[model samples]
Target: MTIHSVPGDFHIPFDDLKVVARGLVRPECVLALDDGSLVTAHGQGGYSIISSVGEVSHHLAHCDTARKYVPNGIALAPNGKMLFADLGNQYGGIFSLDRHGHLETVLDSVDGTSLPPSNFVMVDEHDVLWFTVSTRNVPRSKSWNHHVRDGFIGVIDGDGARIVADGLGYTNEIAFSPDRRWVYVNETYAQRISRYPLTGSAAKPRLGKRETLVQLSEADLPDGLAFDVAGGLWVTCIASNKVLLVRPDRTVQVIVEDSDPAHVGRIAAGIRESSLEHADMQTPGNSRLGNVSSIAFGGRDMRTAYLGCLLDDCVRSFRSPIPGVALPHRSRRIR
Candidate 1:
């Protein structure tokens, strides 16, 4: 199949890009900090310390001796603490960064059992931390079949957290409604967004109602997500190799696409470099849907779009018309 670059009013040209660092990067979530820095929560061969320029730094000094590393989400605190969604082990949990960039476990479990390889972590307005657990047991993957049958969306009250919604088909992402009245999470296996209405109740463990927002097929697996200032949703297409804009009306639009597969750069030496600088290749065709995994806002007004690619081991960015909403405020503490 051929691929073509998607055009839209909110799109920006990929002419001005700055390389910070590269090499074995699995950056899942990105934050365009106020101080002109980009923080990436990358889980790969190992967790990497990264900057906005796409530079990867050394591991945080203080971390437990964990065998594997995979972080699916992250957020920063006003006081400079950073929280990461740790998804490496079977029982995923949350890790934090001290002032010295040392890693520490903040909230790893509920009821004495660790979170099940939780995905995105969102700190809401009340300082409540919200995230998703793909399964209590890691899905066994034999060849292409995934056997993760159950999933849950959860929230942590000041000292405790509970699964608010369950029996979900692989809940992989979590975001609050713009009005703060509902929580939205993408069921990866189901290929749709499931939302739960929320009142101001404390530690609400329930699902009032549900909406299947934007049903995506295997053509697109709903992965990373962020909202625009206008409340529109931005989702990454894991298989389609596109950035999809989901409007309030649930209309899906392809905002960007890669036309030149030949020019597509991969990370080298822990930094983004052109591997085909010497190899002669034909001009890229239109654009083929690929594995575009995650996306976030950056650049001057949070209008820049960054994409996570699963096929290649690097992150890519482009321009967008809308600005990104700031990470919400959520209070979470481990008991």
Candidate 2:
């Protein structure tokens, strides 16, 4: 397959974007369906659904309101249910929300240890559930240092929940290669993309030797990941508010950017000095993309790119020249 380079001057301008939905609380992860509907992670408790015509309705989990339920990365199950990674202050787990909004714990602990605040959750083509834990640190912010590396990935299937990989540097989002031969993940603090060879049955999956695919600059702290049909991996950076495309040949291209140069410089310096703090990761005031965290391809042709953000109350949409590789749940009907 020929992987053509994107034009050096090509970029998605802020004026070209359209708001798809509003009144959201930290719509961190977005999933676009074939019917023009979008499901995003709601910071308050559950997931919010946006209709094709721009109607917004939130289905919150029926959980205790005392402790905040911060839903980060979410996935749609084949059984017409929604699975979300709860990044709570005092607890963390993978929860399932049914059509009736009933919340149930799917997997809160692996082996016997309780999970820390989770980061992302995904369902692969085989219907297996995978999740990431950014760190075991109490504050979580402490693990933001490049020297910290306690993050890990776990899987849930017929054999039950267990950690598949560990000792990662602040793991964020994960994606599977189109052919299902490998699984790719982003190590936020490490500023790199790594992949592990996939083997074994779905119930007892094994991740082979880890291989670093792309090493990004300190300024580019990758937060989300998705793939295009042309084999280009799209990554969204947080503080920088930039979207990058890593082509099949592993060359990187800047697809869109909306960062304050001075803000990025400070972040880069902090990362290099190993002194990054919570304050340094805050969204820049001049950001136009709301500190985009994830990118998903929607629309009938899969050319409509929807951006999930941290600071914005709505999901942002722009057109993509290349269609995205349809996710396993894209065609499944939402119950």
- Please report the candidate that would top lDDT against the real structure: 2
Query: In model 1, how large is the Cα lDDT of residue 331?
Result: 24
- Candidate 1 differs from the real structure by a C-alpha RMSD in angstroms, to one decimal, of 8.7
Backbone clash numbers for all candidates listed: 22, 0
Instruction: Note the Cα lDDT for every prediction shown.
Output: 0.59, 0.87
Candidate 1: 10-residue stretch with minimal lDDT: 267-276
TM of each candidate vs. truth = 0.75, 0.95
- lDDT of candidate 1 at residue 41, scale 0 to 100: 62
Per-residue lDDT of 60 in model 2: 88
Model 2, C-alpha of 212: deviation from truth (Å): 1.0
List model 1 lDDT by residue over 1-335, tens digit each: 22222333454333443333456355666555544455566565224444545565644434556555576677765455677777764567877765465667777777677676767676666667777776665541210112344777777875577777777766777776666677777776456777777765644434577777777653355777878777788887554455778877677776765544333322111111212221221122233322556666766677766665444455566666667766532222111
lDDT of 2 by residue, 1-335 (tens): 45554555668877778888899889999999999899999998889999999999999878655777899999999888899998887689998898777888888889899999999998877778999999998777777767888999999877889888998999999998877788999999888899999889865788998899999885788999998886789999987889999888888888888888888888888887877776666666588788899999989999898999988899988888888889988987667
